[model samples]
Target: MNVKNIFAAVAILAATGSAFAQQTEFVAPDAAFQSRLTRAEVRQDLAQATAEGTTAQRQHDGQDTVYAAGGRSRQDVRAEAIRAASIRHYGDVNDTYFGG
Candidate 1:
């Protein structure tokens, strides 16, 4: 209404806009995990695993699956990627959670 109130409102709006923009630009650790995955491959693995059971169960069931090899499974890779990104972005994972 008045000049002082208008300026205060504009300042508050500017601060809020900047904070929202910063948050949108910020990438979460889970986003980094998803970004590293090949969507097609991950989807296929997930579908197959879901159709059967767990990936490990499918492997034990004598199904020659791509994920049965001696490497990290899709979930493991995703988890590790998230953990790495969290450590990179936040300095430490446990510290971020525990406030240490």
Candidate 2:
């Protein structure tokens, strides 16, 4: 063939070889398929966490949870809400569009 065709074929072959070379092998994790704690140890840890009431909340378990009370009192919250409501809400199209 001509020199141009030979050069084009070499270029295509070089590109294909470079593309295949630019790959990374899969690396397994350091602790692949292995656990530091046995099943019985895991069970014991779960039991201890349950006894201390530190376990994560599950979905729809039908249990009532009471959160700790905040520092603000009910009257304080009501007063803050009233003060906030009294402040004019800017850009409210429904009320006093001309700032009247």
Candidate 3:
């Protein structure tokens, strides 16, 4: 083929390929598989257990000593203290609102 014909053919193929590659719809989750996912309470329980485990591991590994020292900045310590106090006052604040 001539140069012009070859270039037109290539451009048409490229445009058609890209148009066919577009995704136009959301894929819904499988109902049965989704049902097996941890619910909010189960997630909270797992997260709490994981955090407790992490804290215990840190304590066992002498991380508490390092954490107590200058490893954390004054601002970080103050923030942690405020967070602890808030949790004490309100049990547990909403996870979304706690950080912000």
Instruction: Say which candidate scores most in lDDT.
Output: 2
Query: What lDDT score goes with residue 24 in model 2?
Result: 75
- What is candidate 2's lDDT per residue for 8-96, written digit by digit as tens? 99999999988877447776677367788999999999999999999997888666687678999999999999999788766646665
- The true-structure Cα RMSD of candidate 3 reads 17.6
Of 1 and 2, which scores higher on TM-score? 2
Worst 10 residues of 3 by lDDT: 55-64
Model 2 earns a TM-score of 0.31
Among these predictions, the greatest TM-score belongs to 2
- Model 1 residue 18 CA deviation (Å) reads 0.8
lDDT of 3 by residue, 1-100 (tens): 6999999999999999998785688666664455545689778877898988853444375445444347878899999999987763455567567653
lDDT of 1 by residue, 48-77 (tens): 988888765433665654753556688999
Predicted structure 1, TM vs. truth: 0.24
Q: Each model's TM-score?
A: 0.24, 0.31, 0.27
Clashes of 2: 0
Measured over all alpha carbons after superposition, the RMSD of each candidate to the real structure, in angstroms, is 20.4, 9.5, 17.6
Clashing pairs in 2: none
Residue 25 error, candidate 1, Å: 7.6
12 Cα displacement, candidate 1 (Å): 0.1
Cα lDDT over the full model 2: 0.85
